[model samples]
Target chain A: MAKVYDAIVVGSGMTGGWAAKELTEHGLDTLVLEAGRPITPAVDYVEHVPVWEKRFRGLRDRNAQLANQPIQRECYACDEWSSKFFVDDHENPYTTEPDAPFLWLRGRQVGGRSIMWGRQVYRWSDLDFEANLRDGIAVDWPIRYADLAPWYDHVEEFVGISGEPLGLPQLPDGKFLPPMELNCVERVVREALAKRFGRERVLTIGRVAILTQNHLGRAACHYCGNCERGCVTLSYFNSINSTLPAAQRTGKLTLRPYSVARSLMYDKKRTRVTGVRVVDAQTKHDIEFHGRIIFLCASTLESARLLLLSATPELPNGLANSSGQVGRNLMDHVMGGGARGRIDGNLDKTDTGRRPNGIYVPRFRNLRDGPKSPFLRGYGYQGGGDREHWGRGVDQAGFGADFKRAMRDPGPWHFSLYGFGECLPNHDNYAELDKTKTDAYGIPVLKINCRFGENERAILKDASIAAAEMLAAAGAHDINPFVENNPPGKTIHEMGTARMGRDPKTSVLNGWNQAWDIPNLFITDGACMASSACQNPSITYMALTARAADHAVELLKRREL
Target chain B: MDRRDALRLFSATAALPAVPDLLVLGRRLHERLTARPALRTLDPHQNATVTAVADRILPATDTPGATAARVNEFIDLLLTEWTPQEARARFLAGLADLDARARAAFGKAFVDGGEADQVRLLIVLEDEALRLKEQPGPHPEPFFRTIKYLTMYGYYTSEIGAKQELHFEIIPGRYVPCTPLSAASGPPGGD
Candidate 1:
């Protein structure tokens, strides 16, 4: 007889780790299927590795990146040391239109992308949840801020977010530790913005998933300045740093690395997903794992691809895709429109240590009480002020002793404000199976077709003008306001496709993130997102995963699953 | 946490508080240096010319210079392995051109020329680089600017340059938002 686990969680990443921890802690024997190699922190963590140790110094291996990770190299985190965390583009192939180039940045490992995540955690408000219904853009979200508030509190408590309380309704305050401080120039800009824009444009320290003080037995951040390279102190909230360990503490987690899930096993008679068929990455062999309930926590596009791959004759579109929304309405944050300027006067002042977090300007546009804009949604700015360092020597033409001495001292303080605008859920912007090409594992790849709409561009244009206006108000010089034409999926906050909604006829999943068609199947990752909010999506994904796991456990106890 | 529990959690714990042992870091850097073979590509004359150009660009001041940081060695490594064939060929040709110009000016190779002569020749190259910057087409980067770029890149990223010159700390323990310029210890590469 095959060993049937109580629950099976796919993709041991941000959401998968949370689901595993929540389910296993409730005394369920959960098996975590990770498609990538297991990480040994001591061996793999490269945050402490000095730039001199790398062969390319911080330049990155150009030849290797061009050959293996042409698409992965598009990411800022895919540097010399941390590039190992990202997937090789050849092995994990996905296609996009020549005109519509989608950069599918992925990290397939035990901890997944959580290892190289940006760590900026922000909670979404009712403003975000009810945006679709208010605008009549797409189907309304089944859940709201009220429903997910407790879950946000639940995850934020364990994750150890450090942020200031702004008391803003649009971007609600979370359970925070000590907020990281704003630097001298940042403070100058913050005060200037406060005086000019009042409470509408609040510039606060970034609410990050990094420990300011030790909590839950994990150590506080050592201020290494290299969170993306993997934090050794467990100060940052990567899955391996936090949730997976908590799951392991319960002694009910069975983590299986290098198990690429091929598809879900659908039982037409039972009308439930019985198990998952996986391909062993190392041996190139087929294997099956049975579970009472399944959590499809493989990211947004991958989760949608999984459903498409599991299409049956009974339901030809896809598994649990009765609404035909499994692989539709894809969206990603349209970023790269803002300004940079020279914030003069702070010459005597400088900052010590490398603070991992930056200053965040909360979204102020298109609020309920605020003045209306031409665009439908809003955008937020994430940037900071820093004095120039030795890297500035590249442009300075002077050579010799004086130049060398000058390079040692910090240069003029420069401030930048980069915006991330909300991308509307467009049905045409979606992913489907590309039968012509298969990955190294021989599984079908995704053919994504996504592009930002007029509203997204308008929001970005407004963001640049507004950023420059703020900089001018701050008495800045060399105010260069510009809009960057970044392609879709560049921000890596890709969401939607298998979205949650009120009706099963419109959405794949319900309010609880459970598949409406399959009772035991749940998709709690970014695929469950109905709308693309300007804020970072990981924290919401974590909250939804925990809430869904709780509901799943309840169903199991009642023998209803 | 008790000793038994701490021992069990050692693997689960991301890392034992990131107080970097400079001794271990130094030893590993030393081992890496000791294991390196000779320069694979650059001949003696070309190597000497590169060393001379790098030194003039960032000569030995109160602190060490490009030579001390082994900018020549870094250039050799890049040319041999990292740089594309076309770029590598252009770089070698540029080095040869520098020698020819040196001979034309002072009847000697760039390595054999005095500091004043080398400076005069470099001034001409800088002017060319500046001119190239103004008129942008598909022209390959001016050779002198490339050398300068490599010299700066190689020097700043070196252990001596980054640690001794810039004071880059592996673990800066706590973040201090505002401090006097004189009080600031590490190089300014913060968020």
Candidate 2:
């Protein structure tokens, strides 16, 4: 007989790690299930390995990649060093509209995408929480900024976010460690923005999850610019490095890798989730693990797919999907292209260390309190300035020893701002379990249909033009601006399939990320996002998970679940 | 519409190989088993030509040159395993054409020619290659461009090029924003 736990978290990623940490710490026996292979940072991480030592010399094996990973190869982090961390497209596949290409990148590992995250973290204010209500487009988020503020503080204290405190209500300041210092050009741009537009456009160092100082026995970042390859020093906040370790320390957490969660088993008599049906990835044998409460933290699309696959005669749409809103209102951050140009000044000034972060141009358009714009939402820019190095030699004209010598010295300083825009929730942009498609584990895969609508195009155009304008104000040169219409899912910030809403008829989950129909079920990953706030979503997911886990534990204590 | 027509015309001419697909199944199997990649594409004559051309492109200074870093081996490995089938055929044909050029200019193959004569032939080839610029296909890509491009890439990324010639500090402990160029004495790309 399978041992039952107090709580079972399906997925061992960003939110799952937080759920496990919180549940286990609160004296609950928690079992964390991970679909992918277990990762040992010491053995798996190759951040220190130089390019020349690799068989393909960092170019990667193209023929081999073409065979296994056609879609995953597009990612920048999926290099020869860290391609193993990314999911193979062959084993797990999702369908998209041929005309509307949605690049669904998945990393089905113990740490999931947390091990390969961009590490940019930010806070969302009432501007995001109340976006739908004010616009009257979708249902209002059941919770507000006031409800999540303390929870944000609770998660930030443990997660160690190093950021600058900006006292704007729209983008509320968080509990932060000492912020990273900006480069010379970034500093100049900040001064120029202040001089030209006052406090309207603020440029600050990118508030990242990477630790700047020793926090909770974790070492500081060594300025190696190799955080994507799985940090050895535990400087960056990955699930494997931070939360999972914290959960392990509690002695109540049990991590089961290579366990692919098929669906949540619903008990009609209990009127809640009783157990989770999973297939051992190695053995292909089905197993059921019972739990009082269930936390579905399996990314965004996967979690929705699980719910849809759990369809029974009582709930034909899906499990706990009485509202028929389980797979509706799918959203992702509108991303792809931004603006960049050459900065003429700061030529004499070069950086002594390689900063793992970049400059952040916070959202300035479509302000709730301020003047209105054509677009419905705004976008923030994440970019940096750098002098061209040996890599530029590929583009530079000429060859021979002189060309080689020329390539050795630094070239002109170029500044680029890649924007991440807010993607509003549209009911049409949704995911459903495909009829014919099944994964390697015989579980139905997600058929995702999403696209950037009119609002997103306007945001992209404004962002590109605004980026060039800001650079021009800072006395930048050779400014080239164009709206990069990259296909959706390129940002890897997929969210809002099982969104929380005030009304049960319109949404699946409630304010606390608990299913309205099923009290014991919770989903605190990107699937819980009501709106795709312009800021990065990982930190918010962590805060929401911690808040929900604490509430679930309280409910368990009272025997309400 | 013109670009479409161009694309249409190009597609009409199949992305077919100039020669039979050169499958070194035995060599590739052996390389995979050993786990250290072996040169599978270029034979000895072609290999010698690549090395000779690569040396002239980025000759040895105080630091090691392309030949010392074994760019031919890297190029061969890439051409064999990484490059598309069509491009591989083009590259092979280009190699034969290069040797033909050597025979045309002098009386023997490029490897058999004197160093001075080889340098002269390479200079002419470089001019011819550089003239094509970014225009690839329909017309055959010049041999010099292929060799020169791959050699530079292999050399600059190699340990001899990056660590020795271009300074790369593995663990720069602090974030000092503005240092003078004199103090910041390394190429920016560190792997």
Candidate 3:
């Protein structure tokens, strides 16, 4: 007889890491199965080396990207330094209509996209939670602000979000460490924006996951500026650096990497998840493991894809997709609408060190007790200040000794504001199985049919205008607003495929992130998101997973599973 | 050897005609070097010419420019290796038409033109390229957009370009968002 575990987490990514850590710490025998290759942190990270040290000087070969990740080029970060972390697009092909293009950026490593995340951590307020209910779009989320507040605090305390307390309702205040200080230009911009636009528009240092001071055995960030290469200092809160190690310490966790979980095994008599079926990526052989409970944290679309592929007599659409909402309401933040300009005043000033993060302009419109916009939801801005570097004159053919001397010093101070606008959940924008296409493993690929609606386009247009206006108010010169040609998922913040809601008729998961149909199975990744809040969803995913794991342990003690 | 003989020898040594009777020689060289079943889907002639135009726009002078940085080669690699087959074909077809127009006007191939003549030709074609980018109907050229990207990538990545032109410090360990204008002057130092 095979040994039965108390729980099995389907992924070892952001939420899966949290689930494993919390479950094992609670003395539950947890088995974390990762679909991708194992990531050994110390060995994998090569960020500390100088640029001259690498073979391609941190540049990827043309053949490598073409043969491996054709779809990943949509991301600027998927270069030679970080391409290894991204999924091979050719092997995992997906379909989109000719008119619509969906850029599904993913990392199938143990840490998942957490290793290559932007590290910005912000909390959503009642404004985001109540948006759907107010607009009459999707069903209202079962849990509200109060229910998630404590979990946010719990997550922030452990993750060490570096930010200032801005007592704004739209952007709720999180438990934070000392915020990173703004540079001179940023200070000027912040003061000017506040004075010119009133309290509605405020600029603050971004709430990043990187630690300001040493906490939980991890050292503070050294400001190396090579974050995409992976933080060797463990300053940034990646799953491998924090949660995975914590899970290992409990000794109740069994981490099996390269174990691709294909689907969940349902026990008809028990009316619960009996086990999980996995295929060894290397051997291509199937293996079954029995678990009392299961956690589907295999990202948003992958989790949905797994269920859609696992067809049964009871679940023709997919497992636990009773309401046909398993792979619906796909949303992502609409980005690339912003402005860039040269600052005239700061021509002589220069700063040292490339800060790992940027300055944030919190959600100004539709905040608590603020003026509403024509659009249903609101957006935030992530901008930064920097002196123009040597590369600005390359188009003009400025070179030689004169060019060298001129470039030795910094040029004019420049600023840019990029919008991170909310994408309203539309049931029409969804992911489903494409029977026509199959992966190397012979599994049907996900067919993503999504496009930005009127709301998202309006948000982008307003954001572009607002960004230019902000720069103009800050006394910027030659401001230019850039509107992206692509649609919603271009920002790579894909969410809401298997959303959590108050009603089983409209959602696949409940308030506790447990499946409505299968109580033993929980989903706390981006899939459980009821709405795509403008803020980065990783921290919230972690908090939700931790809360769900605690609930799972309690339910197991009572023999619920 | 005379200039024409020298051009021919040079072209032969470089694996092609330096100054051939036919303008298509340059086009054929590009096609032969970049030939691959996967790559054949996209036209190499269009990719090369567009890259050449980008090189002309930001030509190599005292510092490295687009061609010297192998921006065109980079683009070819990008198209052949990464770009979808459909996009590649569209890019190539657009490039061929661009060269054909240049040949019709100058009575010589685009590559064989004097620097001033080439600059003038590009200036005229730029409007057409821009139109294609903005209101792309059937078989959009995307020449202007590709040129813009190539210029951005080529210039930013060059050593003198990034260091002198952009004034980029490989590692500015600290961020001072607001600082005195005078603080940015003088030699590079710790943040």
Candidate 4:
């Protein structure tokens, strides 16, 4: 008989890393399985190389783009430097309806999407927590702000979030390091917005996961501006750099790579989950590992799809999916609404080194003691200041000796504001197992069917107008507000497929992130989010996973499992 | 054979070889074909025709002319390598259409026409391309966009085109968000 472990965790992303760290530290024999390829830090990241030293002038070929990433092109970060982190669409294909195009941007490696994440960390306030209850949406989240506050502090201290304490109700404050400085154009825009719309509509620097000062054995950011290419110095807080290494130090972790988890092994006699059945990716041999508890952190849709595929007589629909809400309530942040314009008067002053962080205008419209708007929720603005580079000069057209002299100087300052709007929880937006289509691994792929609703459209329109007004107030010239035609999942903030709630009828997991039906199972990835918050959910997911892992350890000690 | 001879023969036969001789040959061929004096050295009629058409599309401004930017050479390189077979064929067809349009409108080949006549012919071609971009077709818009993109790309990336048309700073050591317009007009600070 194979030896049984105390706990098993799927995936090695944001939540999985936290879960592994907490479980291992608590002395539990934790088996962390990652379906993707292994990652070697520092050696794999080639972002530190200077532009002058690069071959091909830092541009990838047409074949590389077409072969490696088709869906990833929807994102600006899927360039030559970071394309390796993203999955090749041809090998891992999924189906969607003809009209409903879902750009499922995914990275299948040890750290998963955390390797290429934008790293903008923010805390979700009561506004997001209470939105579902007020609107009578899918289901009210069982826990409140007070319940998760301590866990948030615990996670933030470990992650090293660099931010300012704004004391805004919509965007809550967290344990933060010193905030990054805003550039001149950003400062101008901030002042103009504050004067025009009052203190509530203030612009602050974004809270990034990068370390401001050296901490946790990682070096401070050198401001290389090649973050998407993976940070070699471990400045940015990716799971591989921070959490997973911490977990490994505990000696309780059994990290197995290329172990594709196929299904959960259910024992009818025990009336509980026995273990997980996995296929060895290279050998193509079926293997089973027993665990007292299981944690599914295999992303939002992937986790839900696994549950749906795990068919049994007692739980035929899916494991612990008695509520029929396993793959329902798919939500993503609605993005791509904002304005761009050239700044007037200030052209002489140019400063350097590509700044990784951008200016953040916190959510203000729907917060406490703020003005009412047509939209239910609110959106935040992320803007930055820059001058024309060599690429832009090429676009405008100039050549010869005179042009060469001119190209040496930077152009007029330009600024752009992009809005990240809050997407509400809708039951209709969902994913289901596509039995007709299969991936390269011969696993059934998820068929995503989701669309932006009326509330999202209203918020997007208002966001565009707000951005234009802010630019105008700052005395910008030739302002152009663009509304991009993008469908759901374009933001790559996919969440809320297996939500945690008070009642079992509407939600798959409980407040503690434990499955309502399966006592030994827990899910703490984006799937466990009750509602999609406007803020980046990675930090919150980390907090929730740590909390869940601690609880799971306590339950095990008490012989609850 | 000796090791040096064997290595030389091996490098000579390989496509896109890293050998010094191959690299030098490729660079010389590119420069010779694109040089301004070499362009003038062509058959007078052929030279006049190509120069007239190129100048009409991109006139000599405060900076260098399109002919000085070596746009024709860039186009030739793209036609040979970067572009697909279908796209290359379409671009060649578009060039033929330009000559035909010039003859029909002014009763003279584009090469034989004066500067003003060539400019007028380009204006007609521009309108046609714009119409093609708007039309709901799979092929037309891509073809037009490709030509426009290449034209702009070749011109602006060139040293004179980049600096004279739009200011470009390769390494602006710092990021000063706001400064007076006059200070920005000169060479970057520290340079």
TM-scores of chain A in all candidate models: 0.99, 0.98, 0.98, 0.97
Per-prediction DockQ comes to 0.48, 0.38, 0.17, 0.17
Worst ten in a row by lDDT for model 3 chain A: A392-401
Best by TM-score: 1
In model 4, the Cα lDDT at residue A342 comes to: 94
lDDT of 3 by residue, A1-561 (tens): 999998899888788889988899999899999978887768788665554333343456656776678888667778767888888998778999988989888888888888888899998878888878888888898888898889899988988889999888788889898899887788888899988988778999999998888998998877767676787779898889888899999999899987887778887676688888888888999999999999988999899998888778876888888879999999999887899998877555556556688889988767657678898788899988876654454433332345444644666777899998888888899999999988877778999999988888898888899999999999999999988867656677889988999888889999999989889989999988888878877888888888888888888889877
Worst 10 residues of 1 chain A by lDDT: A391-400
lDDT of 2 by residue, A1-561 (tens): 678899999999899999999999999999999999999998998777878888888888788788998888888888898899888897898888788788888898999999899999889988888888988887899999999999999989888888899887778898899999887777877898899999898888889998989999899888878788888899989999989998999999999999999988998887888888999999999998999899999999889988888888878899868887777787878875477888886666777677888988788887877999987979999998888776666544555678767776787888888888999899899888887888899988888888889998888888888888988988889898878778878889989889899889888899999999899999999998889889999999999999999999889888899
- Most accurate candidate by DockQ: 1
Candidate order by decreasing TM-score: 1, 2, 4, 3
Q: Candidate 4 on A279-370: residue-level lDDT in tens?
A: 77778788898999999988998899888888887677988888999999999999878999999755656645456788888887777666
| Model 3 fnat value | 0.34
TM-score of chain B of each: 0.78, 0.72, 0.60, 0.64
| Candidate 2 per-residue lDDT over residues B24-118, each given as its tens digit | 53455345444433458888788888888888778887788998788888899888878898888888888888789889999889888887888
The positional error of residue A202 in candidate 2, measured at the CA in angstroms, is 1.6
Instruction: List, residue by residue over B12-70, the lDDT tens digit for candidate 3.
Output: 75674455545565566556554443333335555556556767766665666665555
Encode model 1's per-residue lDDT on A1-561: one tens digit a residue. Answer: 999999999989999999999999999999999999999999999999999999988888999999999999999999998999999999999999999988899999999999999999999999999999999988999999999999999999999999999999999999999999999999999999999999989999999999999999889998989899988789999899999999999999999999999999989988999999999999999999999999989899889999999998888888988898888999999888899999889899999889998989999999988889988989999999999887677666677778788888988999999999999998898899999999999998999998888999998999999999999999999999999998888898999989999999999999999999999999999999999989999999999999999999999999999
> Which residue pairs does candidate 1 place in steric collision?
none
Evaluate candidate 1 and give its CAPRI docking class based on DockQ: acceptable
